[model samples]
Each structure stands twice: as structure tokens, then as C-alpha cells.
Target chain A: MKLPSLRIYAFAYLAFLYAPILLLPIFAFNDGTIIAFPLKGFTLDWFSQMFANDTLGRAVRNSMIIAGSTAVLATAFGIFAARAGTRFSFPGKGPIMGLIMLPLVLPEIMIGGSLLLVLLAIGIELSILTVILGHVLIATPYTIAILNTAFASLDRSLEEAAYDLGEGKLSTFRLITLPLVLPGIISSMLIAFTISLDEFIIAFFLAGNEPTLPTYIFSQLRFPKQIPMIMALGTCLVLLSIILLTIAEYVRRRGLKKTGAKDTGGFL
Target chain B: MRRSTASWGFWKTLRATSRSELPKKAPRAEKWRRAMHLASFQFPLPVLSSAMLRKRAAPQETRMAQGSPLSRLKHSEAANGLALISPTALYAILLLAAPLLTILAYSFFKDGYLTVIHEVTFENYKAVWTDPIFRAILLRSLIVSGLVTLVTVALAFPIAYFLSFHVRPDRKSLWLFLITIPFWTSYLIRVFLWKVILGYNGVINSGLKSIGLIGEGQLIEDPLQMLNTVGAIAATLAHAYAPFAILPIFVALEKIDRSLLEAGQDLGESRVMTFLRVTLPLAMPGVVAAVLIVFIPTIGDYVTPELIGGGKLPMVANMIQAQLLPLDNKPMGSAIAVSAMAVVALISLAFVFANRRYLRGPK
Candidate 1:
């Protein structure tokens, strides 16, 4: 734990974590098809190739569609569940909340497998729709947990004032509650979208013929040569996830500061 | 002088002997009842905490409220709360609960080649035990997961310790950001990268050879032998679960009271002994949490093993996936799913039990 040793250990750990990531962009820009060292001359040909593939483009489009839908649906549900747990008094409330959060601890395989069985029983064939439904189930709990604090911190009187003005619940929520907690809502949506986008095992089980990006990436890696492209895709995903997570952290911190709950919640 | 000194020494002797009382043992049923009670108690704490929070927070409530006091918002607040969470509730019912229900029903059925016949039977469970491969892979999955848990926790502890205790303010986030590297990319790509690194004529052997570390022709090929070995699988899995291990340990470290460490030093323990006696014991919760996080998921991991194992090994996950996807044997697959879930549920229960007793708080 000496300062120098700690520094070395910290940097080495970082190198181990990030060296492969560093390799991705390097190879992505390499003009040569090979992805070995003794650096190939730099070029963006592979990125250009990425644009030419219609199927890849379509997959991206489909992924965007699914990610967006999952985010909105999951966030909407999260806000409700979070509110119920935070503000309401009802019987069986704890069990219900535990059930909502149950998927968090349960294996994704179990959830996915069980959902597959249920979907088949209902004659719902796997598709992007099915994938979206599954994503929503897993993502909702996280959304709810994150939004719970935001909902908890909201000055309830804002909604109360709207109600006293004779506004209905829906309108009050739309106008007062929604606007004040918008930062949390946005954070929940971003995280949910990223979870849906990068999610694989669930998407693999649910996305029958219509593959999402992760599934597409899975299939592409079956051949050794396609790995470089996968690395390129991974680099893009890594960059995207970092941006998404950073924005999520920023918005969440801002929301916490806004509500004056910044120092607590103990590691989030 | 003699009388006073004798009295003081006698009192000290009495105190030392009195301190060693035999610990009381609760009856088995008593312990069980208390556990059930404690878990039940925890069930409402979150709800109650938020409510009691309302009272303590009254001052801020008035400042933030539009017109009336903050507590007045409760009448309309509950309604708005329900509205916000409806989508999450609806999706959970349709996708998660419904699918799990179907599996429960299917677990009772029989499959014939292409069709699933609906008749309640435990034959699938019986068949699950009879299958040798199922037994082997289940055990293998457990072993692999145990290795992954052990390795990742061991590796993550030092880095987490560095971040939590050793680092300056400016560097904490950077180290955490670095630790998050494993999580940022497609998991499949990382698996494939290890495939190259561990493959015959891959980097490890070839690089070793150029440096005269190993002779030529000693390059590690025969991927059928090496790729899917437990070692390879665990290495890849360790990387995946590292972030999971880091998060909880980091949290636990941050929660460590600095005064306790200073107390240990004030007691004249050396640095290493202070860490062993003081810091390690307190971080036990994080270690247990790390195991739970890493072990549970690693056991269910089919993708990493499947991609990297090259058909040599099949974890329970791969088996479950195959049964449902390609083989189209839904009943058996659902059975596999149930079996796997049964194991996870049991471990989780034990984890809760341990958390209550050893870590949450003093009795």
C-alpha cells in the first residue's frame, strides 16, 4: 500500500481493464485487415465498410427501435412502482416490492428461461416485441429503484397544490410531479435503454429471427476473421456505454443535489 | 499502601474472571423464529423509513412545498405514485410472471419428439437426475463458478482497497472508471479476445517463444484440449465478474469508519496486522456480497463457456439454452431451468441468513 506501489497497482489494473479496449480503436483505424501489432497504417476503411452493409444498418435501426421502446416502457413502469413503494400505504406492499426487485438478484437465465416458457405457453413467438417485453421486466426494477429516490424527494405539495387547484391526478402528475422529477426520469430512461441495447442472453432467448446488436455480434464472432469487426463494434459499444453511464451518473448526481440527498444513499 | 494495593489488585482479578462468562445458546427453534422475525422486520423498514423520514424532514418540506405543508401532499401524492409505476407493474406481470408460470406448468408435463404433451408428471424431474451429462455439467458449473468467484474477489479486493483507502481525492473516480472497463463492451467480444490470447499460436505462447521463454513447437495449440478447460473459462469469467465484485467491496470500504483504523494504530498494531485485525473483518459483508453477486451469475453463465469452451464444456446455462432453442425440448429445458433456480434460491436464502447474523449490525 505504499504510494508508489499503490500507483503501480492502480495503473496496472487500469491497463489490464482497458488495454484491450485501447486495441479496438487502434485496429479499427488500421487499414490492414490483420489486427496484430507492428502497427498497420491508419485508415477508416473498416468504419466506411460499417456504413455500406445494409443488414447491419437495419439491425442498428431495429436495435434503436427496441432500445427506445424498452426505455420508455420500463421507465414509465419504474416511476409507478417506485412511487407505490415510496409513498403509498397498502397491504402486501413489502412482498410486492420484493417481487419487483426479485429479478435483480435472480439469475437472468432463470428470468429469461421462465419468460420463454411462459411466452411459448401463450403462443407469443420470440421477436423484437418479445425481446422488448423481457427487457422491460428486467429493466423495470432498476428503473424503479433509481426513480424511487427522485419520487421520494419530490415536495409532495407541488402535486397537492395542483390538486387543490382542482386539477386531477393525471394532470398534476403531468405538470408538477413529472417536471420536478424529470432528471431522474431521464436517467432511468438512459440506463434502461443501455441495458436493453447491450443485453444479450435475454435478447438471445427472446429475439427469435430478429437479432439485436448483441445477438448479431454473437453470431458474427462465430468466424475467427469476423472478430476484428466485432472488436470495432465493441469499441463503439464501449464508447457508447461510457457516455451513457457518465450521463446517467451526471443526471443522477444533479437530481440528488437538487433534492439535497447528495451525500447519503451510501454507494447508490 | 499494602491494603489499598491489595484491594485494587483483587478487584482487577475479579473483573478479569467475570468477563469470561459462557455464551448462552438459543434453542434451534428459537433461532429459526428470530430469523423469520428479523427478515419480516426488514420487510417493512424501507417503507417505514420513508414515512418516518417524512417527520424529520418537515422543515425542508415547508420550504419546498408550493403552498401548503409537504405532508399535505400525501393525499394526492399516493395517487401520483401509483401512476408513475404502472408500466413496470404491467410488464412484470405479462413477461416475467407469466413466463415463469408457464415453465412451472411445463415442468409437470412430458415432451414427445416435436410436441409438448400437457399432463402433470414429475417424470421430467426424475429424468433430470438420470441424465449423466446434466449431473456432470451441473457440478462443473458449480466448480467453475466457485473458481470464478474466488479469483475475481481475490483480484478485486486489492484494487478496491487501493481505491477506498489509499488513493487521493482526484484519483478515486479515475480508478473506478477504469474498473468499469469490463462492463462497457459486448461480453461476447471479450470472450473472443481471450480465445485468441489463450489459443494455440495465440499471443501468450508466441510472445513467450520470441523472448526464448519456451522452445519452438511448444506453442499451445490443440484448442479442443485447452480452450474449454475450466482454467480458460474461469479466466474469462473472472474478468466478467470483476466489476460486480469491485462495486460492493468499494462501498463497504467507503463505509469503514476511519477512526477504527486510527484506533487500531493507537493500540500499537503494525500496519499489516491492523489491516488483518481491523479492516478485513469489517469488510466481510462486501466479501460475502461479492461472492453472492459473482457466484450466482457465473453458475448461470452459458454464453462465456459456450463461446470459449468450443463445445468441450456445457454449463447448465448452455444446456438450458440448447433444450429450448435448437433441440426444441421445452419440457426438459424448463426442468433444467427449475433445477438451476432451485440451487440459486437455496444459496440466496443462506446468504440472507448470514447477512442478518454476522454483518447487518450488532445484536
Candidate 2:
């Protein structure tokens, strides 16, 4: 109450941030093509149309393949890197870790362009595989970030205790360490999947003739008649993203709790 | 007053009597009582409170303590670290590092009419540096991104402060959670939503028209042209990057030792003075981090400017995209991308240095 204006300002800020995104579902259900308002009668024609499109379905399938593969690869890579980073320090550790995290901030356009040139020059054709390659590059950093917290929070004594009890290193990892960090792995996979699923530029550049969801939406945006269907698709995507992120955030928090780690502000 | 002191004496005597029978439980009971007091406490500690430092360093200390037996652990750990990290290291080198190095190499190569000439030269870099359009777009991109960072961080600070200081401990996570829900939505769609809202016949225009701010006939003729402008881009960028700004700042604020603020106040400073002299200074690292996080990505963003800026106000990323694909100028694109990366790298370094300075207290 002492700074009532600050409270109001925060609310307004949240509203300004969320209001535009709230429009997607509104227009998706509106029985109109033009994005202008006068609240047309409600209809699900756009959603039905979106479902009936073959190209849209193929794009969705392509995106799913790319996202799934990227998630597994990135999370797997993340587990190793995070474990190493937390457990040990070596020469050039700082620089190596910095280089790995660079893609998180580096422009996707640069990575996409660079990758496209290299792949083409090397006589490799572009496809969903190339997109997955690009996605793993971007998603790996995020996975590492999440998994780093998980690995760091792990009580090292737990591992040492297992070792003290005569368990081999690999068996100790499997029996104790892996089970302890399972939540972290699941969280990392979910985050990587969400990131890869919604990724645009890399998929745009590397998909070549293949149509992913973003590229399809971008292409369809040029046609005025397809706007409603795109809106419908956007609505569904927004819902899916909310659900996925909720689960990811939940798992992340749960992992932190299980490991007795302090929350340092994750995706949620 | 006499009765209260007498009761306190009685309580102390009672505790002393019970201690003999429950020696092990005594320390834990006292610890629980102290914890409850700290939890309900509203004041803050002085700058660099050792208790806060100890609390923060608890995990690190434990990690180091577990890292004894140097000769044995080192050999095994070193080998295990190398083995464990190799897959990711190899992946980065093959996909990310190789591509980036290729781009650097390509930046020096010549682009012939049909085939890319293998001959290396400084032609592309020279073109990027000397071209007035590239310079203008680069400057514009930096300015736009700077504005976005400033606005986003400024708006996020108070929200983060409110969350850290005003919100209840139990509800803070929920508020933070709600704040990030918008982030889960596709960023491209969020940018596109801004386009819709700011379009000629879009939400803003229609709302103004319905409110009679514009004549009915003028709706089509004289709508506010907000899209494709720098202001629009900045607004959209700020909205898109709010969570990125808010979360870091909130984390920084949350980590502040509350007794520090109380110490300042106890030293005869007013509330505002205490905040200015204590709270803001401690939160600077987070603010710097938030700025860097928002600024770096926005400066290199092609999508927002492409969709919302409508190609009229192309950022450096947009120019790079044009050269790489439609313009058939990979060398030039690589040069621009590399230049942008260098600039971003320098800025990040400066931010990292600033964060250290903040942590070390202006020394």
C-alpha cells in the first residue's frame, strides 16, 4: 500500500504483455476472414478447415519428427555436459562452457545461414534432418542450462555413499544418480521439445522444400483467405504451448524440491 | 513492566530446567524458534551480510567438501569429465563450431555470378563496412534493440521489485508462474498478434473508431499507421521479452538480504534513501543481466522486424537473411552476421564486467 502506484504499474505491464496474445483465440472463433472486429457470429469453420488441410498435417508431422529427435539428442547431450560441468573442472572449462552456451544468445539467422551454406557446400541436401541438426544446436544450450541446475543440486555425498558401499561407477550412476536426476532429465526433454517445436528460423532455412508448421503459417499468411485457418492453428498452438510449459515448469520445480535446491527462477 | 520481566525470568528458568532432560532437542527447538523469527521478520541486513553469504554458499561449500582426495578424485574426475562431456563437445564442434568457422571463411571469399569463387578476399567485409545502407540499418537495429532493452528492463524492475518485496512468500511462485504463461505461446505468433493489433483496420483502429475518435468514413482512409514503425517494433519487442527481463531481476532482488535494508534504515536513512543506497545497488547485476539477455536477442531478431516492421525498417538480421537467400550473396551475409556477432560479444563482455563490478561493490 505504501507504493500503490507501483502495484498498478505492474498490473498494467502484465496486461500490455498479454493482451495481444489473447486476441488469437478470439479471432480464431469469430466467423470472419478479415481480422477487424464487430464480433461476427461464432463458428468452428476455421478449426475444421485447419484439420482438413493435408499440407498442414504433413507440416505438423515434419515438425513433430524434428522436435522429437531434437529433444532426445539435446537432452542426452545436456545430461553429459551438465554432469561433467558440475562434477569436475578442467583446463579451458570456462571457455568451453561459454562456447556451448553461445548459441542461446547468438542470432538464429546467423546459425541458420551458416548451417545452410556449410550443408550445401558439403553436398548434403536439406531436409527435416538438417532442421533437427540446427534445432539440437540451439536446444542443447537450453537443455544444459536446465540440467546444470539439476546436476549441481545433487548431493555429491549420495554418489560417494554409493561408492563407499562397493557399487561400481556405472552401476552407481544407474542405480542412484540416474534415478535421482530423472526429474531433471524429464524437465530438460520437455523444455527442449517446447523450444524445438516452436522454433522458426532454423526450420525455415534448413527445411528446404519441406514445410514445417512455422514456414507453412508464414507462407499461408500471404493469402488473405487463409488468415482465419492460421488463427485457428495459432489458437491450438498457444493452448498446447501453455500446457507443455506448465508441465515443464512443474517438473523443473519438482526436481528442485526433490534435490533441496533453491529456486533461482526457471521458465515459470 | 515488572510482571513481564518476572515472567521472562520464569520462562528462562523453565527452559534451563527442561534443557537437562532434553539436551538434544534443545538446540533444534531454539533453531526452529529462530527460523520462525527470521521468516516473520521484515527488516534487512547490512551490505554483504555474512549469514546471507553463508546461506548462498552452502551448496558450493558442500560440493567442495565432497571433492576431497585430490589425487584419486582428480584422475578419475578428469577422465570421467572428458568422457562425459565429449559427446556434447563433439556435437557443438561439428554442427555449431564448424558452421560458424565456415561462415568466417566464407566472409573472405568472392561471390561470382553463378558459382562461389574459392578465391579469398576482404571484399565482403569491405562492402558491409562501407555500404551506407548497411551502416544505417545496423545503427537502426542497435538503436531499436537498445530502446527495447531500456523499456523492457525499466518496466520489469518495478514488477520484479513488487514480486520480491510485496508478494507473500507462498504466492510469489504463482505470480511468477502467471507472468511466464505468455512466454509459452509461440514468439512468432505473439509478434504477429502485435501486427494485428497495430494494423490499419486492426484492434486499435477499430476500437478508436467505435469510440467515435475517428469518423466512420475515415476508418479506411485515415487509420493510425502504427505497424512497420520503429516504435511499434520496440513495443512488440518489449512485450515479447518481458519475461526474460523480469525473471533475472526478480532472482537478483529475491537474493538480497532483507536485513541490509533494515540496517540502512536503522542508520537514520529514510525508506526511499535506504532503497536508493542499498536495494538498487545490490540489484544492478540482475538488471545488467536482463538488459543483456533482451538486448542481444532483439538486435539480431529477423522475425519481429520482418513481420511487424514489414521490411520497411529492416534490422541487421533481416539484411543478413536477404543476402543469404534471395539476394544470393552468402559472403556479404556472413560478413554482416559476423560483424553483428562481434558487436554483441563485446557488449556481453562489458555486461559481464559490469556484473562483476556490481558484485564487488563499485571497486
Candidate 3:
């Protein structure tokens, strides 16, 4: 009890942060229409409703496609740039890398709004493709950030030795470098995928008539009756996101260990 | 001497003629001639164009001394570097740079009735600058976002400090991980959950009523109009950004060398004194980073205030959304977006400049 104030404050702080979100699953399962304390007996109706909705299914499908495409696209681009960045000395390296990571700090609304204008001006129809484009732009930075460590920590001597032994450059890269950084690649893909999946504003502005999951959830918010179902969906999404992030963090950490690199913090 | 000079001239003519005919000759004949020339000279020709490398290189002889294999590797490396990075560079330019510049360009144009005027003008900027409501919303958004940053960082510091200093090192990541799980959830859902919790008949009110804080069946009047207020929005925003604030500050805190704190304590400073004198100063970079990360996005946040504040307290983002979506004033929205980015850039620059000492860390 000696100066226990800090401990109590920390507990209260975490509660304040998490308690509201914890209510998401609670009220989703609650049988009552009104979201409140008196939990009407639990039921699976909201889950059923969420699964039965055709629009929700379509939105889910659209989101999955966008997220998957973004993950692959961003990670592929990330690998090349990260390899170039780590393995070679080049001009304008600082500015080039800075621009690549700029989206991490730039306001998403600006990105979404500007891209929306540009897309319209160019007469490219807004679809899940445009959403994927935007997601890839944002997700690329995260992928590169993850892959930089992967590429940087790699022992250069291994590649040099392969080359010295008369291995072709492409074959050497394929045989040695790819397998070593596979964990980083996996981590980057998962992180990029998660980022794209949870993303809203870019998808909202650019998806046009197509509904992604976040946009669908936002649209459904106007109708009070759909609240419970949205909650159920939220519950499932939160669970899935946790699992994905945990695996991603694990892979990233494992990569660091494999390369004997110091942990410089990660998603976790 | 005359015969030697004549022989040298003959050999030079032979070499020149052979070089000229080498391209037309078969590969085997060219290789045989090159091998004969090398054997006669007892040395190999430089792989790099000696004239080009020497003319460009200030340390010409040094590069020549490093020889062909390394130079060939370097040449191919430069090419490989370009080849590797070209795709991402192209993608960023086309997707990110072009659109951002377009937004900047659009801010200077006029919006027609239903279409954008191709004529470039500063009318949009002028209108956005002069409009009082727009100015007020912009200022209010900055203030609200600033407050949220302050509140979030303040709240996060204690938890981060506790986690960094008190928790077992082995379990620290677990604690950090648990705290950040909420962050991975959809931001819209998180905001909506706040709405449900703070609504007039929402969780808090219902919980209070059930405990008899309000009279039975007094549902007609709102017991607490918690929703649709700046404070509520700030609270929700702070909650949403808590993990962001915590993680950075935790990283900064954990980086503080334990020896420094021990040294401070050994010198008769209390734990609190050591933190204020040593820890706080060292962790400023993280705090600033946390501030910038939370502030910039929250200022442009349309979802939180729209959902939680119920349009009563519109942020700059709401106005931008209004102009773009319903009003169809793309130029005005573009101007607002530009102005918002400018304001954030200015504030961040100022913050960084003001805290240059702390942010730069220990010399």
C-alpha cells in the first residue's frame, strides 16, 4: 500500500481504454435491441443476421480481395526496394526512402481526397481496384519498414561467397537470400494485409459504389437496428485481427532472432 | 632505330585494322587475336573504359588498381540497384506523388456549379482563407486534436512508465501486446462502441439508472447528454489513440539506460526526481512523436466527430467532407485539405524546432 496510487491509475487507465470496446461483443450477443447494461439473455441471432446479409457478404468479399491484392503488391514492391536500399549505395537514397515512407505520416484523408480527384479526372472508374491501389500506397511503407530490417541484417558474405563460387546473380538471390528473409516477407504481407483490411477512409472515398467492410459498417450505423449485427461483425474482425497481428509479430521477432538482429520494436 | 620505328608502325596498323574488323569477324577469330595481343603485351586491358573512368574519377589510378572484377561488380550493382527499385519508385510517383501534387494544384482553382473550372485561380484559397466558419472549424479542430494529443500522451506516460520500469522484462511485451489489441480493431467500430457507451440511453446512463441514480421510469429526459460534445469526442479520440501514444513512449522509456537512473538515485535523488530530471528529458522524442502521430490524423478525422458528436461539433474534416460529398465543391475541399496539411506541417515543424534539444537526444 506504499504509494499504490500509480498502480491504481494504470489499472483505471487501461480500463478506460478497453472497457468500451469490450462492450462490442457483450451487446452483440445481448438479445436486447438497445445497447445497455441490463443484458437481455444472450442469443446467436445477431451472428446469424450478420452471416445472412448478402450486402455484408459482398462487402466482405470485396475487402478480402482488396486486402489480398494489396498485401501481395505491396510486399513485392517492398522486397525490391528494401533489397536495393540495404544492398547498394545509391544517389538520393535518403529522399527516395523518405518519399516511400511518406504515406505513413501523411493524412489519409488528403491521400483519399486527392486520389479520388485524380481518379475521376483521369476517368478511371472507382472500384475495388482503386481501393487496392490506395491501400497498396499506404501499406507499402509498412512492408518496407518490416523488410528493411530483414534485408539489412542479412549477411552479405553469403551472397558474395555464392557469387565467388560462380553462381549466377539471380540464382544466388533465389537460392540464398529469399529463403533467409522469407519470415520478413511473410511478416510484411500479413501486416500489409491487416492494414488494408482494417482501412476505411481510402476505401470509403475510392470504392465508389462498391462497399468494403468498413464502409458497409459505417453505412449500417445509420440504422439503429443493425447495431447488434455490426457488433457481431466487429467481434469477429477483432478476433481475426488479433490472430493475424500476433502471427505477424511472431514472424518478425523470429526473423530478428534468425538474423541475430536486436529487437528495435515491432507491431506488438 | 629506323627498322624498330617501322615495325612499331606496322604493329599499330595491324592492331587498328584488326580492331576495326573484329566486329565483322567470327567470335573465335576475335578471341584468338585478343589472346595474342594480351600475350604479346603480357598484361590484360582494363575492363572499364579507361578514358571515361579516368576522366571522371579524381582518384583515377586507385580505381584502375582495384581492377576489372570489382569494377564489373560495381557497374552491375548500380544497374541492379536501379532495376530493383524502379517498380516501387514508379508506383509511388504515379500513385502517391501525382495525386498529392494534383491536390495541391486543385487548391488554386475555382469550382463551377457542377464542374471544376479548368481556369486556374486563387479563388478557392481566398474563399477558404476569408470564410469565418471555415476558419473557426479549422481552429477548433486544431484545438480539439491538440487537447486529445495532450490528454492521450499524459495518460499514456504513466502506463508506459509502469510497463517499462515495473513489469518484468519477460512479460513486458505481453502487456504491450494486450494493450494494443484494441488498436487493430476497426476504428469505426471503436468509435461506434463509444457512441453506444455514451448515448443518452447508452451503457453508462442505463447502468446509472439501474443502480437508481435516476428516478424509476425517468427515461423521458436524458440523465446525461454525454454524446455530441467536444469533450466526449476528445475522450473517445484519446481512448482510440491510447495505444499509439503508449507504444512510442514505451520504446523511448525502455531505451533509457538503467545505469543512469541508478546513478541519479545514488546521488541522493528520489525516484520521482530522477524521472523528472533524467527520464522525462530522455523520453521527449517519443512523446513528441506520439503527439505528432495522434494530432495530425485526429485533426482530419471525420468519422469520430460525425459519429460521436452527431454533427453538433464539426471538425475541419467534416467541413472538407461536406464540401466534397454534398456541396460538390471539389476545389474548396482541396483547399481545405491543403490548408489542413499546411497547418499540420507548420505545427509539426514548430514543435520539432521548439523541442530540438530534447528531440535530438543526448549529445
Candidate 4:
């Protein structure tokens, strides 16, 4: 309760969170090869090398491909499911919806292991495609859960008005509902994107031979000198994730406000 | 830890008990419906229609059982929901169940060198349960993770509380966003940073020595026993799982009515006392949820423990992974997986119970 203690503890914890992240750019700009914090002159060589290195380049490209595919696939499933869940008074809805949300609670290792078994059983090659499928399955639940409130918040009267002018269900959904929930859709997509990009266990098992960014990082840790470059990459990723997730939290709040749902969670 | 508990099969039986509503909806189609029910294909669409019929006839049930609509809705669509949710239900069932079943079967089978010939034997569990290494590792994991969860929650609570209660409303949104930013970054990167900073030529070692706080380079390669010990493992895991812990706690704290805390203060309680009595009680569910969020995942988490626990402390998950892969010992691995699941399931059940109790109790 004391102001001084609060300030001290808060500062210490914040430093704990930020200090390692701050090191990323420092060593990244260092003229010397070592990462330890002695005075090293500045250099952009590592950043330049980060751009030029063939393996890192391939890994980054692969990561982009995987992450992008994962985001789209996850969001698409989320949309249909969320629509069904929010609008219709359907049978077995609660249980079906719960089933969709199971992956959010179930252990990732179990999911990853089973997926690996099935992929192996069916003789599907371990590749980005399989990884995308697994990510979509896991990430869709989160996408749907977040978007459920968004879709549910929209007034059915608006859709009925569209219907009054002779608009069909599909047309009314497009013209009226889609515009109302676009921000929610966008936020869900970004959240799904962030989740997919950072996911490891499924990617680890299903990634066959083509490595992802996380996988690449995992392999690089086996070598000592690569730690600095990894830190640089990590620093960039931390900034990027923070930015995207911030946007997600913002859009989530904005979407809720736009649709006028009482903020149970508000922004956070 | 071998928990054999199963779902209520409650859904399956619910349909069988609710035959009264079926006749009213499909008086003409009763035969086909009955046959379908017999076949156990009482799927989703039928269930929905049945639910509609049930809702229409709800007055009678309301008078009879004195139940809420939500509870009645359970019986009407129980079979159909189960059938409709079958694909996903089955997916989870197969995905989680099969490997665990494999583990259970293997735990009963003897471990072999190259070829894992499946013969039923209980010797593996007997051997594993008695081993000192297993006992030590298991205890070490529990103690370290318990400490980590405590520390993480203790550390995260105030920040979450501040961001929720004290920060300006405008800045509150972005600050919450900043809290989750670390989550999206590579966990390996953060753990490795700790490694570098704590190493001999690393930041802490050289910086300390230079400042005359300790002798030269004693920090780094001098076996870093402390750096990579249980302490580092706990630190890294707490760091990784803090966001998870904080989110729930923040949710709990944010959802608390501010007036109540003020009311406590108005009634002559100090701020700290008010927090302990009112705000903290209201946030108990969140605190429990936070603990579970950190604790459940921390159990199977091999990543942080592997990186930071160094070689001295191989957690259960690491041992299981070792067996499943290079060791070619599926049986032992399955046993480990099953046991770990048992531990997780127990914790998860307790967490749910605690959450329910807290939500319903005095606060």
C-alpha cells in the first residue's frame, strides 16, 4: 500500500520484463562479435547479415508463409462457427460450441502428439501444410470465442430490416452484419495471426524438415555464438508481437464498443 | 496419479429419459424417430427440432421438476448435441485419449530394448514408482513450480491491479496490451538471454567482477550451479507464464466493483485492510485461475525446464520425451505421460472446485 514500495516493486518487475529484450538491439548493433555488455562500437552488420543470410532468409520466408496460411484458415472457420453459434437457436449447440473451444484448454502436447500420429498414419508428409491445418484447428476456437461476443452483440432487427427490403440471409449477412462486425473480424484475424506465428508445439511436431522461425531458433540455440543474433531476432519479434497484440486488444475493445456490448472485459 | 475418471455419460442418458416431447413434435414420424434413437444416431438436427418441441412444452416440466430452462435445455438436446459435437468431441477424445490409452497399455507392458513387443506387465510402474531419481525429480518439479507460481502471482498481482485500478483510463488500454507483448515473442529467446547474462563472460559475471563485487569470472563457466539450478528454472517458467497468470488476475481485478473497496474504506478500514477484506476476496477466483493457468502448463512444460534447469534437473516431461523418441521405449514413455496427465487432471479438478467455491462463497 505504500507508494514508495509500490514504485520500487513495479520498477523492478518492469525491468525484469524489459532488460533482456533491451539487450537485443544493443548487441545487434555492436561492432565486436561478443554479446556481453562491454563497450563495443556500433555496427549494422548483424541486421544486414540478418537480411542476407540464406538460411535465416528461408526460415523467415517459411515463417511468413506458415503464419499467413494459419491466420486465414483459422479465421475462416471461426467466422462460420461464430455465426452459427451467435445467431441460430440450434440443437446440441452448447456441446458443439464447447467442443470447438476444447483445444484452448486441452494440453498442446496431447494435440501435437495425436496430430503427429495421424499424419504419420495417413502417410502425409510433414510440411507447412500440415502445420497450418493443426494451427487452424487449435487457433479457430480462440477466434470463435472472441468473435462470438462480437457477432452476438449485433441487433437482429438490423438484419430483419435488410430482409424487409427483400434481402436474403446471405445478402443481409453481407450488407448489414459484416459491416457491423468488421472490426471484430479484423481483431480476431490479428489475434489468430499472433497465436499462429508464436505457436511452437504443433509446429515442432508437424514441421517435418522445413523449419519455422521458432524451430529455427530452437536449432540455433545448440550453438553458442548464434545467441546474439537470436537475441536480435527475438528483439525484433518482441516489438512486432507487442505491436500486433496491442492492435488486437485495441480492436477488441473498439469492436465491443462499436457493437455496444457492456464491457465485461472492457479493453483488456 | 493414474486417474481413471470419465465424463458423466450424462448426455447419453438424458435423451433416453426425455421421450415425452418427441411424440408431440413428430406424431406422424414417431416410428422413424424411435428407430433412430434405438440406433443411437439421435443426431443434431433432430435434437434441435426436439428442443423446439420441448421449449413449447416447457410449462408442464416447469410445474413438474421446478428446474430452470437452461437445465431442461440440457436434456432435450443432450443426444443431438453429443452427436453433433461428435466430430470435435471425438477429435479431442481420440487426440487426448489414444496416446494416454497407449501409455496406460504400455505401463502394463514390459519395456524392451529395440522391439517393443506388447506383453502385459506391471513391472514398469513398480520400477518407476520406487526409483529415487523419479521421486526426486517429481518432488523437485512440484516444489520449483509451486515457488514459481507463488512468485509470479505475487509479482503480477500488483501490476495487474495498478493497471486496472490506478492507471488513467486512456492509458489503461495500451498498458494492458504491453503486458501481453512478451507472450508473442519467442520463449527460447528470453530464456537464452538469461543464459547469456548469467554466463562467465556474460553480463552479470563480468559486470560484477569489474565493479569489484566478486572475483574475476567466477560467475560464468564455474559450473553455474546456481544460475542453471532450480532457481533459474523457476524464474524462466514464471517469466513465460506470467502473462497467463496476470490475464486471469487482471480480469478478476478489473471486474471487481470499485465502490465496494471504497465502501470498506468509508467504513473506517485502511486501504490495505480493505484490499485484504474486499478486493482480494472478490479476486480469489482469479487468483486460483491464475495459479491453475501457470501451474497446469508448467507441469508438462519441458521447454523452460530443459533450457534453464540445465542437465541436473530433468523434469517429467523431458524424461517422457526422451523415452518416446531416441530411447525407443514407448511403454515407459506412455506410463510417464499417463502419470503426468493424472497429476495435471487432479490439479485441474481442484482448480475448478476452488474456483466454483470462491465464486459462490461470502464475497
For the candidates in turn, chain A alone yields TM-scores of: 0.88, 0.97, 0.94, 0.88
- Candidate 3 ranges beyond 4 A from true positions: A1-11, B1-82, B216-222
RMSD of every candidate to native, in Å, equals: 11.4, 10.1, 13.1, 8.5
User: Candidate 4 — which pairs collide?
Assistant: A92-B81, B108-B121, B200-B220
Clashes of each: 9, 6, 0, 3
Query: Which of the CAPRI classes, incorrect, acceptable, medium or high, describes model 1?
Result: acceptable
Question: Candidate 2, which CAPRI tier?
Answer: acceptable
TM-score of each model's B chain? 0.76, 0.76, 0.78, 0.72
Model 4 residue B150 lDDT score: 92
Q: Write down the worst ten-residue block by lDDT for model 3 chain A.
A: A88-97
Tens-digit lDDT track for model 4 on B1-363? 000000112223335334545656545455554654544333323334446434433443443443676666554333333433455445445544554455566667776666566688877777778878877877777787788889989889988787677666766655656666676566767777777676657777666656655654544434233466787788777887777777778777876888898899999999889989988888887788788767766766766666666656888777776776668576776676667667777867876776674655332
Which candidate's DockQ is highest? 3
Q: How far is candidate 2 from the true structure (C-alpha RMSD, Å)?
A: 10.1
Candidate 2 error regions (>4 Å): B1-74, B216-221, B347-356, B359-363
DockQ of candidate 1 (2 decimals): 0.29
Tens-place lDDT per residue, model 3, B56-75, is: 22222243345586665556
**lDDT, each prediction:** 0.71, 0.80, 0.80, 0.68
Model 4 docking category: acceptable
Q: Model 4 off-target regions past 4 Å?
A: A1-8, A84-99, A105-107, A261-268, B1-124, B216-225, B266-268, B351-356, B361-363
**DockQ score for model 2:** 0.35
What lDDT tens digits, residue by residue, belong to model 1 across residues B1-363? Answer: 111112222223223222332133235534543443345345423444334333333432343457554445643433344444455555666666767778878878999877899899999999998998999989989899888998989988988888888877556655675576467456766776777667665555545655555664554333223576889999888887778888778877777899999999999999899999989878877788778878888888878888778877889999998998899889999898888778776876687587754464322
Model 4 C-alpha lDDT per residue in residues A51-131, reported as the tens digit of each score: 777888787888888888878777777776666554443445555565566666565665665566556645789898888
